[model samples]
Target chain A: MTRVASMALATAGALLLQGCAGWQSALDPKGPAASELAWLIWFFTGLSALVWVLVMIALVVPLMMRSRAQAEPLAIDAGADGRKLRVVMTAVGLTALILVGLTLLSFFANRTLAAIGSDASLTIRVTGHQWWWEVRYEDATPSRILTTANEIHIPAGEPVRLLLTSTDVIHSFWIPSLSGKLDLIPGHMNVLDLKADKPGVYRGQCAEFCGAQHANMGTFIIAEPRAKFDAWWNDQLQPAAAPTADEAKAGEELFLKRPCVMCHRIGGTPAGGTVAPDLTHLASRQTLAAGTLTMSRGNLAAWIADPQGIKPGSHMPVVELSGDELNAVVAYLEGLK
Target chain B: MRAAVAMLLFPILVLAACQREERDTRPQSALGSGEQPTPVTTLEPGGQRASASDNKAASFEANAFHMSEGKRLFGWFNCSGCHANGGGGMGPALMDEKWIYGSSMESIHATIRDGRPNGMPRFGDKIPDDQIWELAAFVRSLGGNAPSSAAPQRNDDMMVHPSENRLPDAATLGKSP
Candidate 1:
């Protein structure tokens, strides 16, 4: 019985600890805003636990103690009664004080959060679609604004402002390791500021219950050094590399002729439709379908062939293609980077 | 035992009734049986006349799914680029009462199939006849010609104006400026 109890306790502990550290955990904070929020969470949790322990002790100790026998069952002890009233008053006063303290702490935390983006150096507009994120890097020059999807890159140690909005329903952008969740409302923009202290990749997700594929709507933030981030941005500004291979060339022709031209846009190509994610730098992205599947040739073919099977209710329609056409399209897309 | 069997079958029957198949393929009727060209008209001399034979408009315009599909295709085909969600930018406004090409379902179908005089590019070659019909139905809905039940509430994009389903009556709207 002892062994079984210990095993169960160990399993529970492991499960609890598993949530403490991960790329997507609030406790494993890598940015200032997240760290501040994490600290606040820990402080509140610790204080509550302490108060609970004190209350449990107060209740259990009295119950365990032997009560003195009363000489008269109806005898009123004024002195004892006065002491008991004072104790009750003290407990009530303490509870009020703790509540007020917590309120003040929360107010200050919010102030800190509000101040985070006041000095942001760069701004990016992130528009929430049903199950994807359209990331556009805003530049002073119209030609320099770069549009990408599902992934965001930022310079390490620099605060970046994100203008979040939704095209459809409400969605909340949450990269737990970076900052708190902010709702992306239709026709209303919300701003979020975050700064990663070091270079690392953090996973993010749509925290709001948007729709059918909401659970699969994942994103990533890649924080790197300033030089590397700049290089990446510059590279992304260029149009898609022209296909040199015969198979890829054939694939591009097929893509232009097919319904793929109707929704997806590839820079420097005549295929300029804007209803879906821009596929100019499709190969540069790490995952497909807003991180639903890892990026691979096989996965790309499968996704193109049966989008409904993969993402049930996605906007991408399956363009009927022969096996050769599928292979060619995949070849062309794979060379987009 | 009989009651238990009946109870188990009840859910299955209910679920079977819930199944609905959305047709994504082009229908044979959309092809017009080679009797007349499927609403393709042009401003050029001796251009084809708009025909009434290819009237699948009622079937598409009355169905909500087809209207929504048309809405999706409108965006996909970059119709919103020129039409600007039916409010019109480079092209004439679709929400207004005045349609340069007649407002009849066949006329609208012709306008989309063959380009208009000033700027509308011919989409007959690019878009399939079934999708063209859907687009025409959606375009009609923009003008409040479609049934209210068939029109879409809103698109998945930013809300710039009232949705097709919720727009005020076309009679209340002004002529295209």
Candidate 2:
């Protein structure tokens, strides 16, 4: 019986642990803040569970010993009652001490997390749209300030500050693997500081629902070595690559004539529209439509041809493009990287 | 999907954009100049419309509700991001009467449609005509109620004073004209 119960408990524990797996799980943290947070969560869970088990035992012990303990206490000896009260007082004192300790632990953990980003070298401003993120890297020179969408690149081991605000409604920016969520409210800028201990790709999402495509509004944080980060930033500052292939050139012309350029901007080109995401480096992003689909030629074609089919209530207009136009546009965008 | 973004902006834009020639013949006055505008219709460059050319600037530009909607659209389109609530940052300030283009209601709409040579993105295609007019009405209202950006002791971001500076025009500033 003991063996079966232990096996069952082990199986249950394993099943519970599965919830904290995968790319989006907070418990599987990759950054300093997130790792500390995960540790704090585990510490509290263990401590609370231990206390609960003890309380349950205290409740069960009286029932199990009722025949002997209760009957013998019927005589009601004054000295024995004093001893029982002393025991209860000691238990209460222990519980109070434990509670105080846990509180201090949380306080210190927060301090540790806060101290990680004081010397951050990079500053990125993330503005929340209804269903996308407009990311701009701040720079002293006006020409050097690079603007992109959906993807953020930070140097590993160096702190980065993200200034968050909303253009429409309230939204929360959260990267479960890096840090806790911070709200992006209208007319107010909130700052969140983060540092990745190593190079990796971390997925982020909008924790607060802004509108219809709330679930699809996602962003990626790519942490790389300092050298690679600098390279990427320099590359992004360049305009969209010129369409070299014949098919891509035709697609570019069609984009100019069609409604595509009206809402999307391709740097160094005549297509300068601001209401939608800047597609200057569209193909370089990991996902399209704010993580609605993986970045690929097929998905780009599908998104342009019929956006409503992929994400209901999305703001992307369904452009009327023939098969050849679709292929050419896809060819153009795919070569943008 | 286009309608979702343009729902609040349908009728107002066409009132201003479609009628081009009639506006040229009308008397030029500053926005809210209290001079009554001549009633007219318009001819569009493309298939868009000359049908609703019979509306007046007084109706579309002076409506209180449309101005309010335009104020909301200013932030919606991230105009604040570059223009910094119209005092000017990346783009020139709209809070002042100082417009490189004409500051009339129609001229402002034209600028929005055919973006300037600098960084102003063309919003004509994505935004419906009504919303554009609403935005124009709001932008035009800025300096009308606010102090100038050139004021010695100015608090100009909110546009709460009268007569900000408009940049010098070669024709009007004792130049070639």
Clash counts for the predictions, in order: 0, 15
Q: For residue A143, what is the lDDT in candidate 1?
A: 90
Worst 10 residues of 1 chain A by lDDT: A312-321
Winning model by lDDT: 1
Residue-by-residue lDDT tens digits, candidate 1, B116-135: 88899887556656677778
Q: On residues B1-177, what C-alpha lDDT tens digit does candidate 2 reach at each position?
A: 888669656667666588732211121223332222221224446654522221335555656655665676677678888888777898888867867766777667766766777798877655545556667777887767312331122233444644436545555776654
A196 Cα displacement, candidate 2 (Å): 1.2
Docking class of 2: incorrect
TM-scores of chain A, one for each prediction? 0.96, 0.92
lDDT of 1 by residue, A1-337 (tens): 9999999999998899786897699998999999999999999999999999999999999999999898897989899999999999999999999999999999998898888889998999999998899999999999999999999999999999999999778999999999999999999989999999989999999999997789989999999999999999999999999999999999999889877887788999998877688999999999999999999999999999888788876777656578999999999999999
Q: What is the TM-score of chain B in candidate 2?
A: 0.52
TM-score of chain B of each: 0.68, 0.52
Q: Which ten residues in a row have the lowest lDDT in candidate 2 chain B?
A: B20-29
Alpha-carbon lDDT of model 2: 0.79
What would the per-residue lDDT of candidate 2 be over residues A53-162, giving only the tens digit for each residue?
99999899988884644666458689978999999999999989998999999999889888887988789999998789999999988998999999999999899999
CA-based DockQ, model 2: 0.06
Once superposed on the true structure, which residue ranges of model 2 sit more than 4 Å away at CA? A68-77, B1-177
